[model samples]
Target: MSQALEQVVAELRNSLGTIGEIVGISESATPRFELFHAPNSICSQKVRAVLAHHNIPYRSHQLNIFEGQTYLPANVRLRLMGCIALGGGLVTEHTGSTSVSMGGCDPAVVPTLVDWETGQVLVDSKRICFYIDQTAADGAALRPAHLQNAIDAEVAFVDNMPNYQMLAGKPPGEDHRPESRRKGNGVGFAMSKVERCDHYLAQFADDADLVRGYSAKRSKELNAAQQLFTPEAMRAAYDKAEAGCNHLENKLKSGDDWVVGDNVTMADLYWGVELLRMKNMAVESFWANGAKPAVAAFVDKVESIPAIRASVIEWPGAMY
Candidate 1:
């Protein structure tokens, strides 16, 4: 941990009595749900968006990847280290770590959801969104029978593509280099990317600016793995995304207020957050950037909704 984060952890422990445990452990008897995530992670954003739409209260635990806190507890750390070795080298190391204790053994990525009551922890963003949709107090049925498969396919697509974009933008040899090459390189490289992106984002001064900056930097970095952001490639990706957006635009145009159905279902929340990411990436879209009248109208419509608007708006320093 950096001196800064170490200090933050120390102060938190002093204030809350334990380093890793939730704050105000005695506050209420209500079942608590905790989301472990990084601030600018898209998957994390998706989960938060759903929580906001469903009005499900949750505790947010910010994990610092640089500090290796994501692999806390000795066994998980070693297992992660071993996986890094077996994947033909450091390319695998760059992948995130997720242990069963943290919920599952898969994605090991952020936006992990833990239901404190049932001790059920789910890792994938889509699955967690479904859980919230089916279980939250305000859970309204949003996926129509005709559109369920389509919406599910879209969510799955969104879940996987952002990570590919992130990996594609990195310096060559950085992601797939040998572990020896990264002995002291991982944290520094990650932090430097963070700084550069922050610098670019300094131009914007509003909450939207922060969101845009963070999302843009992340998209750029994830796209580094391929190291090729040629216009053709970007356009191709944008074109595919545009199709998804149009599907949504048509849905909205059909007199339904949201993408999946009449209500703001998990489908709406999922696509809404994903579109926010695409918008930040400056992907050409007919609806969002005034490129398409119907699409732009749909963007306006969703943003006008109180819950959806509130969910996408950034809260910089607020914990949780």
Candidate 2:
């Protein structure tokens, strides 16, 4: 293992305690698959289930996002230092450093999969899950041939649910500002207290200017959320999650154990992960109260599979 990976494993053990040898455990010398993910991430859960179902082993890198570990210089590099000249004889300059002492992975999202054999690095969960299933030579097949497009469409619908935006800040909406500011603006006023304290700020303690700038940037997001994320929006988010559950309930009413067909498929994996998020968020009553009887039974049936069971991880922020 690299020294950097060793440090991450140590840090995770220190904070999470007895989580077992998770990060840094290599399944092979030249691992074809290496995954960096947070256990609680819904995307991560889906990817894990796909891997488990195929019995594909991977080297794991655990990232705790709430701590800002995902943004750590050791994990994600920021190339912010530059000089820009305005048309009106004005020059904006950065002093001293070429960059903020750069290092870390790019596209710093959780559940990043590095496939050494193919030299491909995948970021999106749906893409990764599809890739794995497609490449698998032998395994429980996850996609029914004719239903692929429908499954992909259903997955996208669940993915766009407003509750997901609520979990972070808010769902994306059109804004004239920069992307971060746009995200902040759409976010509701309420904030989920982070599972871990912000450690990213500490890395810049020696640079007062950087600290101030970063803090101000985050403050703008909070302010925007307060203005945009209102009570009506929050209720709408809840309703959206309920709607996702209702969709699943309707699918299950067909009396099949799976979401799309007789066998497990991408649609089942997609909804399985989404429902897991609902369970973690404490709003599963949307399922319990609104969904039909078959919905719960379907969940019970899917989660009972050895692959799915092995894929389950404890969410640090789960309400229950």
Candidate maximizing TM-score? 2
Which lDDT values do the candidates have, in the order given? Answer: 0.49, 0.54
Total clashes in model 2, counting residue pairs 3 or more apart in sequence or in different chains:
2
What's the lDDT of the predicted structure labeled candidate 2? 0.54
Distance from true location, Cα of 278 in model 1, Å: 2.3
Question: Worst 10-residue stretch by lDDT in candidate 2?
Answer: 78-87
Which lDDT value does model 1 have at 233? Answer: 47
TM per model?
0.58, 0.65
lDDT of 1 by residue, 91-114 (tens): 211222121222223222355665
Task: Give per-residue CA lDDT, model 2, range 36-69, as digits (tens).
Answer: 6777666677788888778777766667755555
In model 1, where do residues sit more than 4 Å from their true spots?
Answer: 1-30, 64-108, 142-147, 160-235, 284-290, 317-320
Winner by lDDT:
2
RMSD to native for every prediction? Answer: 12.5, 10.7
